[model samples]
Each structure stands twice: as C-alpha cells, then as structure tokens.
Target: MKLIDHTPQSLADYTTAQVANLVPDGRHQALREAIGRHQDEALARTIACIDKVAAWRPGEFNYLHSSQYCQYLYYLANTIWVREKDAASATRLFLLNKALNGIDLFYEIAMPAHFFIGHSVGIVLAKATYGDYLVLYQNSTVGRHIDKIPTVGEGVIIYPNSAVIGASVVGDGCVVSQGARIVDRQVPPRSMAFTAPGGELALRPAPEDLLREYFRL
Candidate 1:
C-alpha cells in the first residue's frame, strides 16, 4: 500500500509527535520506541481496513484524510495493547484520537477489520459484539446498558444520530436509519429500522444491499 507523504519511519515519528503535543507530560522515549516496533503491523491492519472502503482508493492511504487517520490511530492503539501490552501508550493514543477526531473509541473495543465509517465525528461504541462489514456514521452510538451490550451482526449500517442500546440485537444486513433508536429490541436481518409517524420503531425490508455503497463487496 502507498502511504501519501509518509514513509514508515516518518509516519511513526509523526504519530509520536502528535501524541506528545496533545499530552505534554508522558515518558515518551519508550512510547516512541514501542510505536516504531509495532508500526508496520498496525499500518498493515489499517490498510486491510481502509482498502475495503469504496470511497477510498484501494492501495493508498492519505495521512491527511480525517477518516483514514482516525482508523490509523485506532489500529496503532490496538496494536500497542495486543502486542506490547503497553496500556499507558495505548491509553494515550486513545485519548489523542478522541481529542483529535472527536470520537470515543476506546483501545479495548474490538472492531471488525473491514468495517467502514462514513464520518468520524461524534461516534461512540461500547464493548459490544460487532461483526464484519459494519458501517457507522456521525453521531452514531452502540452502547451497553447495565453491561448488556448490543449484538450487531455483519453488513449493518447505523446512520447518524441513531443508536442501538441495552441488549439490542441488530441482525445481519440491518439498517438503523437516521434518528432511529433501537433500545432493548430485536431488528431482524435484511430489515430497516426507522421512526414511524407516531415516533415509534418501525421495521421494513431494506430497499437494497446498502453495504455496497461503502464497501467493495
């Protein structure tokens, strides 16, 4: 994959500099080293992710791209946590992502490698069961209620301002439309969840394979 305006070493340096600038008091020498050690694996993971998104060119990564950078930061944090077991650096990366991207995706959250995001702003995800090809947009949320996390299946899209909460089951190929909320309810596969005229939940078959819009598959 081609990284625009960044070599491997330069991207690692840039990441360390960004994190250090955001948080000025950390012991960053080791953090820098850890990042260098794990950067290749993280970038590989990120390439696997963004390459599947239809909006981006398959073999190129633009560091200046907001959505791509957001995914890169996440992959780096996750790599540090899983490979180096360095929680401090991982937490810093997570906080830096939140500060820079306006999203709250913790380092511990397990996201699918091929999932796509329409926008990176105001998105929040809890420790939920997320499947492959998950699509999310701005202001979308998947949160837990009293430790009952949502189970979201593959090829699902959660639109802006929509939420799946409290043990909700969003089945395969479901679309939680804009402004819809599924709280403790089950949305069957290949269906669309939207707000009815009476402001209640409504389910109907999805008009098409919406994932085609975001993913190459």
Candidate 2:
C-alpha cells in the first residue's frame, strides 16, 4: 500500500475520528503545530538513514526524491508525536527500552493520529477501534475478526496477553487481566473479564480496587 501523508490536508489523514478524539484537544492542537514542521526534521533523518542503508550494497535503500523525502519525514515526525503525545509517552519510553535492550516490537501496530503511546512495547494493538485513555501494557492485543471492529470504551486497561476482538464492546472503566481472551462479547462498566475453561468467560469486579477508582474521577 502506498503510504500517503495526508496529515497536512485533513485530520482524517491520520486515522479515524475515534482514535483522534483520544488525544486531548489542547494536545491535538500542539500535534498539528509539530506536524507542520515535520518535513524538515524528516528530510534530515531520512537522508542520514538512506546513507547508512546505502552502505549495505546496492538496492538496499530506496531511491530518494523530494516526495519520498517528505514521506520519510512524515514517519519520523509521527514517531516524535508518539514520543510526546499523552498516554503514548509511556509507550515511547517502552519502545526505547526495547530498542536499547534489543527487544523486537514487530507485532505493534499503531494507526496514525492515535495518541497515548504510554507503555507501548510488547503491546499489539492491531485492527481495532480504540477510545480515549486506552491504557495498555505488554502483550495486549486488540485483534481483528473477519473485518469487524472491536469497540473499546474510554479509560480501559488491557493488561498483558489480554485479547479482545470481534465487535466486542469493552465498557468504560474495565480492566482485562493478564492472559485473558474475550471475543464477540460485551463487558459491562467497572468490571473484570477473565478466561474460563472451554472457551467460556467470567465477569466480576476487577481484582484491583484501583480499577474503579478513576470512575469517580
């Protein structure tokens, strides 16, 4: 697929409205300003990476042009946004931790304009619809099922190895525990979902008292 940088044209260029709404209005405006200057930074970094890649024999690096150069800038610029955006800041730190430690985050997928990378690495947010304040940890996945969209409510916590998919409605103030799998279902507000035998599931007040503390906030 051709990667087009439409951020300059419209907010829709980044991702869906759901994802964009996750970022605070103030922060979103800041991101807009930062993106306006992204081209310059991207060009510089792209040229450097190109030169480094070029040293690895012929055809290792794609030919660079003004358009391609801007595209490079767009990617890096998004990375910068990811680094600084709310919630996503944690994710960026996790990314740095993985990079410095030589861990692989190949499974991580982030849609453009989806802010809050807080606690990112080891997290796999695939083709899923996310709401605001979506706090996630390592090994979490919002997977896809037959092209259906999973709806996650605001202020939700998806812990390690927790998988929710198939048009499921993950309610507000919910905490999905480690190693749990929820599919094609609706989890109520202020609840915890756990995996039971025979592909069954259980819902109860989240094990952690702090899980619902923010509901009052």
The candidate scoring highest on lDDT is 1
Model 1 spans > 4 angstroms off = none
**Model 1 C-alpha lDDT per residue in residues 95-168, reported as the tens digit of each score:** 98999888999888888988877798999999899999999899999999997889999999999999999989
Q: Which tens-of-lDDT digit does each residue in 1-217 have in candidate 2?
A: 1223333335222422222355443344444445444534433444443332322222222322322332243344345555445334333323433443222332133432222223444555555666655556666778778887788886677877788988888997688877888888999987898876765679898655453332222
Name the lDDT value of residue 106 in candidate 2.
Answer: 26
TM-score of each: 0.98, 0.47
Q: Given candidate 1, what's the lDDT at residue 207?
A: 71
What is the model-wide C-alpha lDDT for candidate 1?
A: 0.91
Q: Which 10 consecutive positions of candidate 1 have the poorest summed lDDT?
A: 22-31
State the RMSD for candidate 2: 16.1
Candidate lDDT values, in order: 0.91, 0.52
Q: Against the true structure, whose TM-score is highest? A: 1
